[model samples]
Target: MPYKLSATLSAHSADVRALSSPTNDLILSASRDSTAISWQRATDQPGFVPSNVLRPSSRYVNSITYIPPSADAPKGFVVTGSQDTIVNVFALDKAKDEPDFSLIGHTENVCALNATPNGTIVSGSWDKTAKVWKDFKLAHDLKGHQQSVWAVLAVDEDKVLTGSADKTIKLWQQHKAVHTYNGHQDAVRGLALITDIGFASCSNDSEIRVWTFGGDLVYTLSGHTSFVYSLSVLPNGDIVSGGEDRSVRIWRDGECTQTIVHPAISVWAVSTMPNGDVVSGCSDGIVRVFSTSEDRWASEADLKEYEDKVAGQALQAQQVGDIKKSDLPGPEALQIPGKKPGDVKMVKNGSIVEAHQWDSASGSWQKIGEVVDAVGQDRKQLYQGKEYDYVFDVDIQDGVPALKLPYNITENPYSAAQTFLQNNDLPLTYVDEVVRFIEKNTAGVNIGTGGNEYVDPFTGASRYQASTASTGTAPASAYMDPFTGASRYISGSGSTPSQAPSSAHMDPFTGASRYSGAASVPAPTTNILPVTQCNTFKQANVAAMQSKLHQFNEGLQNEISTSSLAMYPQEVTAIDEIFAYLGQTIATPPQQPSVTLTAAHVEAIIQVLSRWPTSQRFPVIDLSRILTGLCPRVLDAPGLKDRFFEALFKASDWSDPWSPPPPKPRETNILLLLRTLVNSFQERAGLEDGAWPTRVFESLSQAPYAVLTKTQRVALATVLFKFVFSTKPRAPRPF
Candidate 1:
């Protein structure tokens, strides 16, 4: 089936991120403009009309899904996800302004949303988890993904599929991992249900793969040249996909049968309507509906215009000179004297100018003629008194002034302005203004008063002078102020009313007064000093220090390399000893355990971590496990958590000269600390007196935001939300 344009809904000022249909005739679109708009197909109307605009979030609304009528909502509603990390459910019949209820569990941007048939909502987020909600309450957290969850699809009551930046698809059964499917080499961006046993998935790698419920790959559909972001199943079982390539491809039987090219660069969303129409949301902020059973949904005039545009592109492409056979690579070896392929044929590159006209009879664009400008065949024209290699026609409206410009490229801007004013019939009153305007707008216009002694270029007469520099015997009336356009009284000349000789001057630098009769030595040298470039020298002490440090590092590396055998065994022995001590402590419980941890304990832990195998994540894992096991035993220990954190910070190996090169403190490490604290605090029912969260907030407020990674920032927010702002469920108070 071929789809034709049906309607163009263009209200969003930002990219439309998602689209959904609550009912057969109603479409909902979510955009970065922080709004979810509902469009309705009016009865007996040619196009859909915007019926409602719901804005529940203050940030970009990234996802929207339709919800069928449930017991809680008598009428069906729409759910929207935004960058605020919250999902809001808006009632269908509520005032076109806000959401009826909100669900907030994700700690990062809520990027994708899907509603199951059982009134269960699934939301995917950058927090690397998917949340299931029922009746606006958190149902379950699906948390196996190692990266941001980009797409979510509820295939059936028993199964949910999630795509993630980790380039894997996870099938979930009751919020538990059923099977992990891995095939794409990049982030999995979109998913569509083909059947209960099969589904389709697209990714940033530009390939759409079909998979079975049993984790079997069916077929890989490849057509798009860029990231495939959206996918939908047609009524006939054919798959429709849109992507960054600006084209929508229809896949059936493992091949693309049809391709619809959009004018936008990235087709962000696609949904199949109940009537078999395809609704596409684009980065250009337009929501367009295309129909397969086209009865010419667009008017005749619009269709003609679109067809003409396509034809014009084809004509322009044809007019561009193509690479010919002669332009191909020459023979492998040098040509023999008097060879058959004499001198190697060469083709001159030329640009073709194709003239197109609207053929009213056929309602299309038609090429009438063509001109080829061959290389070296210079075309010239003479305008006014100057010759120009190119002449361009400038159209003028009935009342708007024409843009008068010089045809020759090498013309003075001042003269051009004069000519333009003359041609436009401008009064002479605007001559000075025009000159100033031209000087302000153009470059290389050297028309201005030379100095304080202003001499008119046209009359060659002095019109102004500086009152302070009036050494000449000119009268006071001769001097005029340029800025105020007024005459001024002459002031004393160089602190003496009587004028001195023109050549007489003082050697101010030497503190020597001017001689009465003889000229000062060298006539008081006119040249004071010449600007010379400073020869900046490198700091010898700093350079020596850096060189010594580099040599020391090299020496350390050499020593370590030569002693690998001894070092390897020593490192293993040290790690084994630390592990054995910790393992024994975990196995046996000590009565009246000490709450205070000392620097010695921290040093042992740091040594084990530094000497451990670099390829394995066991050190961090063991650290998390140790913290998890120790937290429960210290719940009653007051001020012990603060001491524990202080000891951990002091555990850095950078202070140890022999500590094998320490890595810089990274934001990821900070996130690890935050995640551990948040989980631990929740287990302990939050920190008592809530002082820790406050301290954390103050520290974050003082720290530069630019230094924090996005994940680190989000983790900090999650910490605040989970501990500081969180409270036990309370009943609604009567108003």
Candidate 2:
């Protein structure tokens, strides 16, 4: 996992034309994108963009060469060839704005170019000839191949190697063929001089063959699945070749020592630095330098297998029934002695639902289930057929949830009513002190489409409904299909309620309940102390979670500066997003959030959100229902901003505006998006920087804060949090 990616110099507008490694410290690349750029060395930060951009040709530049300038020649000239078929030699020390003279006469595209030690320029062209230039004038036309000469190499003034489409690599001495090797069945694409051996040739036959000056074939190495385009002879006599396979391979003593798959478009050229590392120029308009040091498949297989196993295990566990869906209980519903769940709404947004009694009593979202032992009331059998109107009812169905009513159709006919009973109707007793209020919401109660199981119509939770199942959750194929309005639930069979035998009710299935009697939900926990000064946080939530946060600088002294806390490009961008989501959630929660909300909290949240880009984008396709929802206009957004927007929304109440903070931005949902995108590209494209989308301007520009990853978000939050919470409160402003 410890890999280093260098962006280096990226001024090219097209595929890199050539590459050269004059020293181990620098990487040189010539690109048709109109410039030659250099990278110095490796570091933790991204490499800098090109310090300069230069155009070597008015048209396409085909090849370039560097001659360690000698005593008899000019000190600064670098030779270059073009598709225009002409050769131009320019000064490396000269500024890019000015043009120099040109060496002309090839009537077709120059495919390859090279320079001899003696200041002699050699270029091979599709014109089917190898031309040598001296003093900027064509001196000799080395002709032998019957087809286009594709590559040329000069070992010295007297010897040269020229490969061609004519299916041969010919050794020429003083402009005459000294030897010819023609065993290859396809076009010869490359040639390299072995110092001890005569020459080396690579062909479209996917083979590399070495030969002697006498035309005797020395050895043939084969491994490439496609054309071998370029090769370099090593000091140890090993050979490294680049081919159409997008790979670089090394052969030594008749064996392939290494093969590295790269992301460059077409592995067209290869070069080696003095340190023995390799550099490659590819057709995708890029040049890459890589270190060949570790075992290629060692971590890959282990990592892949590990990931697969983890995924499989998670699939099994998440599939277990988490809840069930059921239809709302009917009027005859009561404290049944035995009843299994039916199709009822149970799990909504991951939380189980509970019913509140319908105290024909206090009108409200009250508890609606049966009560425990009362004054001589055999509550269990006494209310077996009669509905209990004082308490609530609770049931879970098919990994879904629902709340049952307290009053069965018409005051459970089994009850004996007193003449002057208050709104409270528990047969004989009535308590009239507590007044509860409930919003008259008939939305989920109707029989329309049986309440689309896979979607939340009000908050737009259909967005998260993916074609696939959730990770660690059951596969869609394993359960009742929520998308089709169908979810699996259990139905009571073989016996009637109240008569299935009391032994079954003695050890009631849901173990969470500890009360003794006809099952009724114990009252909502008395642990709900009012959240006030007693609930003051150990750490002040000083910073406002939104854009343009107020600073939280007052408490810091010996603290580390967050500027460098986790300076990854990704973490930085996420700092601005987590708060953006928090601001959106307060606008709408599932059900009417608390009645305690005020316009001030609303305005503050809006003000904070306005400083960042909004996430309330338009819904898309059939997937829209789970992924998108109402665009909150409180300077607009939603009630929760987790990466799984739809899933969380279904769990929230559009009426209840309170929501839990999404898992920390640095660890979960928010930064996960950018992390996935970055990781996918790095894998699919190997190590080429050019594969990065130029349209993604921030990353292209090498901005440290452009990544939007998790770690950086945490660090950025540290800083932004201070700024948000540290602002001085202003006096009330006049209208």
Candidate 3:
């Protein structure tokens, strides 16, 4: 093959974080190992050579850029940003491995660096600001981002774009933000210039967005299932992106045309050589070059390496699955109620698929489904069950499942307590004490009645019966409170009976002492420490289970997965279902069937609208008709009309980091709707205050008006201002 492994530039002791090409044959690399190294091809040798290790300090060199020769530095410079929060400049023809000068200002790590065409260096830092440097001094301290600015791209002589953790892309001219575009839901980590009029951005949201120079969102390109860390525009106009998903994806016409998967967890940096070769810096510390030209392809040895790597992964996954299988409820374990053997169930914290066993009706068998789980995750215990799942899996603190019990309000308190103790797992030895505590506590008051059937809070099951009393007389002085691990007594009617003190009130739920006397009930003594330990262990497990469940759910839905056509297949499926449902709901002959959008439909709209115009294959109802015809009629319904507008507002937001703001077509559609809603509110003066106008106002407030041409922004602002003044609450007409 024409394209093969030419050389392995290895010197960094840690993962390579960034890469930049200074010339066709020269490359620069930054690493978490706290050094930046220069690489160049050797004419006399067979491979590339590395030299001049720029170890400015013991800090990770996160970003690097090349500065062109200028009056400040005739030899040009290699600029680097590090975790030390310093931006260091090194001479291009350095005689030794050291920075020429350091620009120190950022209070946090400098994560991104770029050199403008005008010989000014731009650096974005975790301090939430971007600084422009000219003549070796700070020129402009660009400050607008609410979070760390992770990416900065120089578009031309006067314009720059900064992507931030706040999920916004701000376009700056002469250090002032001209417009801010919002699309990504997570941190924007990478940006690339597409053309003079447009650009591309990628984010932790696991998607890419193309935007016009005016901040108009053109389209969203969704394919990566992980944080997109780096991007490069190929000579052929195709966009290449790499991320934590360990893949390099090639996008053409808003779809992923090719995907190059790596054997590492992250492909941190991607760049395109003038020769049409795509080079990537990976977390495995290897620099790989891929060719899209037909004349050259991966060599046989390279292909075999990939094959071996994949095979090894499969084997490792299988072994982990085996280990997880042991954690699943086996046939000997009890099965869920009414579930039988061979019935498929989500087990191992809902991650592993296991089937119930007939012979061992108690639990399930970890069989074939384990392979799917193994393939999906790298580590066995990396994720845990969700919070809701954990809550549903176990009983409450008393070790008593929520159950229905039958008892009469007038039934003897002692008898009711006995029945409860019998049904629950309380020790038989504590029966006398429990009955006495119940009798005195319930004196002159009935716990069980027609209206007082005890319900299990956890399971929501009602207890309908009272426990039968062991004897007709009170037996003991105290019983242990399950929640507080303290002994509770029946005030004046215990074994050590005395006149009941009116100063104390007992709380049955928590068993915490409530006293009005000068001395409160003494805190539980050290004698009860053993009970605390056991309870603490149980509570700790429950909490761990809850946290694990949430982590697992979030991780399971994460977009980072092995795929070429789509980033998160599950999210795509969900989005498709939303559209399908909406299409069926909204696709009717105009105003024929009482076309009312319900809470469900509104929720569905919320899910679909947030990522609108992308994957929006279904035809949408005209916004004018919906506002003029449908919305007014449905205003009386609870949260329906407001929800519709809220959905619209979300759809109109350009803040998503994955894609740009809605293009002019979609933007115009929203603008028209806003005008319609405002006019309608004016006609019905003081009718629906703040219902429609609130959403419109929010959209207008954050809209990138400066980015739009004067005419466009003016048209939008006029409609918004008209709506605001017209909707103001007016004085009552004089009678």
TM-score of each: 0.49, 0.39, 0.46
- Over 1-735, each residue of candidate 2 has an lDDT whose tens digit, in order, gives 111112323455555656666665555566654455544554554333343344666665667776665543344455667666777665555456444658778877676888866677888987667988776677777764556787788878877788887787777676666666779887787888887777888987779998886888899987776668788765556788997554677777776655554443247678876756667776555565554444322245544443343222211111122323244343334233212111111112223233222212112122221211111111111021111322222122222222232322112111212211221111232111010100010001111111111111111112111112111122222222211223222222221122111222222234332333332212332345332221100111112222112211110111133222222334233433333433343344523322222333333323322222122111011011111111122211233222222222222211232233322321232232223223222222211233223323232233244343334344334323322332334453231
Q: lDDT for each of the candidates?
A: 0.57, 0.44, 0.55
Q: Which residue ranges in model 2 land beyond 4 Å of their true spot? A: 1-9, 38-52, 70-75, 292-735
In Å, residue 392's CA in model 3 sits off its true spot by: 22
Put down candidate 1 lDDT per residue, 1-735, tens digits, no spaces. 456677888888667889986455889999877888989887877778888888978877889998887777666888999878889998877666657888978877788899987778899987778888876798777876656788999877657899988789988887667678999988888999996549999987889999998989999998686679889987778898998665677777887766565655468899987677888997667798888666737887865654454334221112233434435333222222212210111222244344333322233333323322222102223242122322322212222212334332233434654565555324444444333332222211121233323221111122222232332222333222211223333432332123333233333335344334322111112334432221111111222222322222222222323222122344434434434444444453623332343333444444534433332222342343344334333333566555544333333221233231224343334445555555554444335557765654564465455555555455455655555333455453331
By TM-score rank, best first, the candidates go 1, 3, 2
Best by TM-score: 1
Predict model 1's lDDT versus the native.
0.57
What range of 10 consecutive residues in model 3 has the weakest lDDT sum? 382-391
Q: For model 3, what is the error of residue 30's alpha carbon versus the real structure, in angstroms, after optimal superposition?
A: 0.4
Best by lDDT: 1
Q: In model 1, which regions exceed 4 Å deviation?
A: 307-735
Better of 1 and 2 by TM-score: 1
